[model samples]
Structures are given as C-alpha cells and as structure tokens.
Target: MKILALESSAVSASVALTEDEKLVAQSFQNCGLTHSRTLLPMAENLLANCGVSLADVDAIAVAHGPGSFTGVRIGVATVKGLALGADKPCLGVSTLEAMAWGARALGGDLCCVMDARAGQVYNALFTVEDGRVRRLCDDRAIKLTELAEEIGEAPYFLVGDGADLCYNTIKENCTGLRLAPAELRFATGFGVAAAALPLFREGKACSPQELDAFYLRRPQAERERMARLAQTK
Candidate 1:
C-alpha cells in the first residue's frame, strides 16, 4: 500500500510518501513561508522527484489538528482536495500522535506538547515499545503547571514545537525529562504517514467528504465573538 501524507499543522510544512511501513520519500520546509503557499507545491514536488503521480498513491493522510488553527485547516483542506481528485481514502492522524511517532526510535515514553499559548499546551502522552506507539492519554488543551504535575518525575522525551516550553516548566519538578532533538521535535509528513498506517489497517480511512480538522479548542475569534455576545446579553 502506498500512502502520501501531508503535515502542515504547525509552522513547518512537509510531504512524504510511504510504501507499507517504509518511507519512500519526504520533503520538509520551515523557511517561514505560509503553508497555504507551500503545502500543495511541496507535495507536488515530492511526488515528481519520486517519479510517482497522485494516481499511484493508494491513500492520503494528514496531521489533522491541535496545532496552529490555520495550519490545521490548510492541511486538511489540501488532503481533502487531493483525496477527492484521486478518489482515494483519506486518513486524519493526530498532530500530537505524529510528534510522538516521529520520536519512536528513541524507545521511551513521550510527552508531546504543542504550544497553545496563554500558558497552555496541546498535550498528550505516549509510550513507544518495540517500535510502536501506544497512547497513554487523550489529546487535551492544558495548563503547563497541570501537565508538569501530572507527568511527575518520570523520564520522558518531550517532542513537539512546545518541547522547550514544557521542559522549562516541568524541569524543576521532573528531573528525568529530555528534550527531543530538533529534527524529531516537530511534526513531519513521514510521521503522519507512519501514524496513519494503523488507522488505515483498522478501516479508519475515510472518503474526502469525511475529512475534518480536530481543533482541541475554539479559535480566538470565536471566543471573542462569544464574549461580546455574553456581554450584550
């Protein structure tokens, strides 16, 4: 089975191709360009460089959410368009899960955190065993203090854009925490492909019509609008 995956749930945008469990090709960019301008083009370039066409891919996968709200939408929209055009199945992998999967080679527990700002993070916990990741917690928007308290002093590799933020907050309380290397810390198309494989196997892949983003919280604009309505009421 061939899978083409896109990851744009953060500042970085990446595209990857995987055949079964093996990654065939990948392109990642964090050059400060907007994902709307880089994502589809990067995927096109990757496929061309690999001498493969969209028609050759069996499924399309993307990091679905819990990162930048705009970035998540761009990724999901792009995947939906690709899947619709190719008439292939689409898989939505969690951005947090992909971060943990990206660091699976480290072979330890993972604390995946994405900077959700305002002293909070999009967080999840996972354990890697025998090269596979098992989730220990559901995705959530949580305060750094609460996260630090929950993780305790257990040794874990922190992975994601918010790795440093989490490390600094929990370091005093959690002595065994380690920050993942720069390469493994952020979301990647390869990670998305790897994380989506199990979901595909479990028949979780869906049509483009079913593709959607998984924002853990409301966007600031929506919150502001609601606040104004509450004030008027």
Candidate 2:
C-alpha cells in the first residue's frame, strides 16, 4: 500500500511517502515557520520529486493531536483536504503513537511525551517488541511526577519534543530513563506513515470527515474562558 503522511504536531513539520512498509521519500523542516505555510508545499514537493501524485496514494495519514492545537488542526485539515480531493480514505494516528513508531528502533519501554506546559505533558506508554509497538496506556495529559512514578525503574527511552524536559525533571527519581537521539526524538511524517500502516492493514481507515484531532486536554482558549466564567460565578 502507498501512504502519504503528514506531521505538524510540534515545532517541526514533515511530509513522507511510504510503500509496502518502506520509506520512499520525506521532506522535513524545523525552521520555526508556520505549518499552514510549509506543510502542503512540502507534501507537493515531496510527491513531485518522487514522481508520485495524490491519486497514486492509497491513504492519507497524519498525526492528529495531543500537541500544538493549531498544528494538529493544520495537519488534520491538510490530510482531510487531500483525502477529500482524491476520494481516498484517511488514517488519523495518535501523535504519541506516531512518536512511538519513530522510536521503534530502540526496542524497549517507550515513553512518548510532548510538552503540554504548566508542569504537565501529553504522554502515552508503549512497549516495542520485535519491531511492533504495543500501547500500554491511553493517550493522556500527565504530570511529570506521576509519569515518573508509573515508569518506576523500568528502563524507558523517551521520545518526543518534551524528552529533554522530562529527562531532566524526572531523572533524579527515575533512574531507568534515557533520552532518544535528536533525530528520532520528535514526531515525523515517516513515523505517521509507519503508525498508519498497521491501521490500514486492520481496515481502520476512515472517510475524510471521520478524521479528527485528538487533543488530550481542552484548548487553552476554552480553558481560559471557563476560568473566567468560574470567577464570575
């Protein structure tokens, strides 16, 4: 199956093409540019350079959420637009799960995290065995102390934008933690494709309208609004 995947859940944005479980081509950028400006262009360039077009793709996939609200929306909207235009199915994989796929080479307890700010992170636990990622928990927003307690002494390789922050904050208490190298640390388009492949095989792909963001927590704007209402009460 041919998959075109997109990732813009964090500061970086990337597009990847994969076929039969192998990466064909990928374009990645982390220049602090807005994803709305860079993502689609990157996808177009990646496909043109690789001689593959939207019609040739079997399914469009993206890391749907639990990261930047705007980034997640951009990624999901981009994939939805592509899938709708091509009349193709969509695979919306978890942002944390996509990062797990990226760290599969490490092969052990995988702690996927993204900086969710305010002493918390968007996290999910997974264990990779024989090149397959198995989720141990649902995606969640968790405090570092609680996450560390959950990981207690079971060696975990941290992967995601929050790895450095998590490693430093919890390392003194959680001795079994190690950070993934910079390249494999963050979410990627290739990882999104890799995560989507299993779902595709399992017949989990959905229509363009079915694809949706997966933010673990409410958006900041909504939270602020609620706080203001509470104050008024």
Candidate 3:
C-alpha cells in the first residue's frame, strides 16, 4: 500500500510517502511557522523525489487537528483537494494518536499533550497494549498539573510538544511516570502508514467534504464573536 501523509498540525510541517510498510520519501521543517509556503512544496517535492504521482498513491493521510487551527486547516484542506482532484480516498488521523504512536514504548499508559497556549494544553491518555493504541481518555485542554492528577495511579510515558514544557510539573505531580526524550519526539512516517493501512484495506476513506479539522476548542474568531455578542446582551 502506498499512502501520502501530510502533518502540519504543529509548527513543524512534514510530508511523507509510505510504501510497502516503508518510508520512501519524507520531508520535515521546523524552521518556522511557514506551513503555507512549505507544505505543498514539501509534498510535491517528496513525490518528485520518489518518482510517485498523486495518481499512483492509494490514499492521502493527514494529521487532523487539536493544534494550530490554521495549520490544521492547511493540512486537511490540502489532502482534501488532492483526494478530490484524483478521486482518491482520504484519511484523517488524530494528532494526539500520532503523538502516542511516537511513544509506543510506554509499556503502560501513554499521555500525549500538545501546547494549546493560554496556560493550557491539549491532552489525552492512551494505552499501548499488544501493539494496539487505545485511547483511555478523550482529548481536552487542561492545566499540566491537573492532567497529572487526573491520571493518578498509572505509570505513564508523556509525549508531545507540551511534554517538555510540563515535564517537571507532571513528574512532581505523579510518581512512576516517564517523559519521552526529544530525540524520540516525532510520530514517524511508517507509524502513520501502519495506522492507516487497516483503513485502506477496509475502504474506510472519505470525500473532500468529509475531510475536516478536529479543533477541540472553538476558533479564536468564533470565541471573539461570542464574547462580543455576550457583552452586547
């Protein structure tokens, strides 16, 4: 199976082609928040590097949400357009799940957290058992320590952008917990391909309209509008 995956939910923008359970081409950028300029180029460039075209790809996979609202839209919209243009199947994978997949060695509970700004983080708990990633909690925005308290007894491994930021706090709050190292940070291209492979086999894909970003919180503009309407009332 050949899957083209795009990940731009964070500051880093990455594109990859996974074929036959191997990564053929992958490009990642952490230079700045220049996803708008870099994402498509990286995608196009990755395809070029591998001598693969959109027509040759079996599916387009993307990290869907809970990060930069604009970044999420860019990735989702890009794949949606590609899928529609080529009449291909589309898969929207969760950013949190991807993060947890990066930390599959947790051996117990897995906690994935992404910086949500405003002194909060988008967080969730997962259990990596027998090679299956299972969500133990739904995604949410909460203070770092609160997350620690919430997952009380389980020995967990923390992964994500917010993990570094909350490392000490989480460690101080919970015993028997491990934080993933920076070197083990990325959700690999092969990992994503593995996650999407079953979906590909099951024909669980979507159209452009079905492709959507998963923003756990409302967009800033929507929140601003709601605040303004409330003030008027």
Candidate 4:
C-alpha cells in the first residue's frame, strides 16, 4: 500500500511518501515560511522527484492537531483537497502519537509534549516496546507541574517542540528524563505515514468529508473571546 503524508503541526513542515513500511521520498522545511506557502508545493516536488503521482497513493495521512492551530488546519485541509481530488481515503493521525512514533526505535517509555503556551503543554505518554507504540495517556493540554507529578519516576524519553521545557521543569524531580535528539524531536511526515499504516490496515481510513483537525483545546483567540464574555457577565 502507498501512503502520502503531510506534517505541519509545528514550525517545521514536511511531506513524505511511503510504500508499505519503507520511505520512498520526503521533503522538509523549517525556515519560518508559512505552511500555506510551502506544504503543498513541497508535496508536489516530492512526488515529482520520486516519479510518483498523487493518484497512485492509496491514502493521504495528515497530522491532525495539538500544535499550532493554523498549522493543523493547513495540513488537514490540504489532505482533504488531495483526497477528494484523487478519490482516496484519508487518515487523521494524532500529532502527539506521531511524535511518539518518531521515537519508537528508542524502545522505552515516551513522553510527547508540544508547546501550548500559558505555562502548559499538549502532552501524552506512550510505551514503545519492540518497535511498537502503546498509548499510556490520552492527549490533553496540561500544566508542567501536573505532568511532572503524573509521570512520577518512570524513566521517559521526551520528544516534541516542548521537550526542553518539560525536561527543564521536571529534571530536578525526575532524574530519569532524556531529551530526544533534534532529528526525532518534532513531528515528521514520515512519522505520520508510519502512524497511519495501522489505521489503514484496520480499515479506519475515511472519506475527505470526514477528515478533521483534532485540537485538544480551543484556540487562544476563542478562549480570549469567551473570557471577555465571562467578565461582562
């Protein structure tokens, strides 16, 4: 099976193509360019370079949420259009899950954290054993102190944009924490493709109309608006 995946849930944006479990091609950029200006073009170039067409892909996978709200929307919308145009199924992979999967080779407990600001992070925990990832916690926005307390002393390798923040905050209390190397620290298109494979095999891929972003919390702008309403009331 062939899968084309997009990852733009953070500052970095990447496109990747995979056949079965092997990567065929990938393009990544992190020069502060907006995903709107880079993601689709990157995908086009990657497919062209690989001598493949979007029509050849069985499914389109995308990092659905828990990162930059705009970035998540861009990825999901792009895949929605591609899936509709090519008449293929779409798999919405979780951003935190993809990050965890990126560190699967490390083989131990994984704590995925993405900067959500306001002294909190979008976080999740997973256990990777024998190249397989199992979720130990659901994705949610949480305070660093709460995260540190919940994790306790279970030696975990952290991976994500917020890894440094998590590591620094809990390092004193949790000496078993380790930061993932730069390459595996953030969401990647290849990781998205890998995470989508199991979903595709389980027949969980859906039509373009059913695809949607999985934002664990409301966007900041929405939160601010609601706060104003509460103040007035």
TM-score (all chains, Cα) for each model: 0.98, 0.98, 0.91, 0.98
lDDT by candidate, in order shown:
0.93, 0.94, 0.80, 0.92
Candidate 3 TM-score to native:
0.91
- The list of candidate 1 runs beyond 4 A from truth reads none
Off by over 4 Å in 3: 187-191
Looking at model 3, residue 218 earns an lDDT score of 95
Per-residue lDDT tens digits for candidate 3, residues 153-207, read 5687878777777676667667767778775565544455656766778888787
How do the residues 192-232 of candidate 1 rate in per-residue lDDT, one tens digit apiece?
Answer: 99999999999999999999999998999999999999999
Predicted candidate 4 versus true structure: per-residue lDDT over 70-187, tens digit per residue: 9999999999999999999999999999988877988899999998999999999999877989999889999999988888887999999999989998989888899988888888
Give the alpha carbon lDDT tens digit for every residue of 1-233 in model 2.
99999999898999999997899998899999999999999999999999888999999999999899999999999999999999999999999999999889999899999999999999999999899999999999999989988888889999999999999999988899999999999899999999999999999999999999988888999999999999999
- Comparing 3 and 4 by lDDT, which wins? 4
The clash count of every prediction, one per candidate, is: 0, 0, 0, 0
